[model samples]
Target: MTKPRGRGRPKGGTDSRSRILAAAIEEFGERGYEGATIRSIAARAGVDSALVHHYFGTKADLFADAADVPLRPDVVVPIILSGPRDEVGERIVRYVLESFERDDVRRRGVMLLRTAVGGKVGSPLIIGFLTRELLPRVARRLDVPDAELRAELVASQIAGMLMIRYVLGVKPIADAPIDELVARVGPTIQRYLFD
Candidate 1:
């Protein structure tokens, strides 16, 4: 008897997801989100278009999977939701710094920052990330009335820091010690977290 067609993702696959993820990152890095297409990513991965679709439902889904921050939504969402607004500043700052400091963080952070700079508007990958992934976590943590603005502010602050510290390698901040950098910037982040 002929084998029945596999539904969803096919079995006996090894690292297909990783291949798609790596290819997606390269595509987004080079093409920006708006310009990156499933076809292009599939080509880069040497997989059929259907495989890409089967692995990840859409480009945004692919991004979330690839850039998957490993931020425990279960833990994060509740922390933000339960914490007092005043304390959000510190929590958000600490959370972001810790997240970015990781090795994997740089890979995904760079991709996100590139998309931001490239102005990948209409890219839900970034938008949903900022709003659904990042913001609500921040907004819930803070007690500020302007949670929306605060969330955006947090993104702006991190983006600027990444640009100077990681991306451009600006003079003073370039080689600053992580502790010193956090010490100096932490308070400001605290303010944003609390304010």
Candidate 2:
């Protein structure tokens, strides 16, 4: 007679969801959003692809769950755009800095940055996320000529700042107080977006 199978994930015990998420993170980090498939994630997690689907509805959903940061673009975009146009840069900078204050959030941000900067695997994912989710929203709100270019410039600045501050852990930029950093960087971002 055939043996009865266990009820949970064969490799990671009962926390299959966590395993899937962790695997998703690794897969996404290594292969990026488009390159990392549910099959690959499931294989990495040592579970069936169906299990991945069961845990997360789709690849986008998996990314959302895996990234697991409070600073979701959908939510933050509206907030940043809602404020006065002149102050939008300040708001964006402050929001990004404030989000990194939390240890977990900071770690996730680092993972994303590492993946994005590493090259082909993660770059497109980050760029797509920024361009699709954030740039369009900000650009639409600005309603200015070359809005797309301005948005891309803003994205570049933010990505560079994050790399310097959190990923590389460079001095001054990394060590400075959030408010001071924001003050120093906010206007530059403002100029990128508005000027």
Show where candidate 1 strays beyond 4 Å.
1-12, 34-69, 77-91
> Candidate 1 on 1-195: residue-level lDDT in tens?
975654455332656667778888778766778789999998887778788889899988886676665556657757644666545445655666667778667667777777767764435556777778777776775567888786687678867887787666687887776666666665676676554
Q: Give the winner by lDDT.
A: 2
Clashing pairs in 1: 80-140, 85-142, 85-143, 89-193, 89-194
Per-candidate TM-score against the hidden true structure: 0.63, 0.69
- Candidate 2: C-alpha lDDT: 0.79
Residue 195, candidate 2: C-alpha displacement in angstroms: 2.3
Q: Report the lDDT of model 2 for residue 180.
A: 91
Q: Evaluate all candidate structures by whole-model CA lDDT and list the values in order.
A: 0.70, 0.79
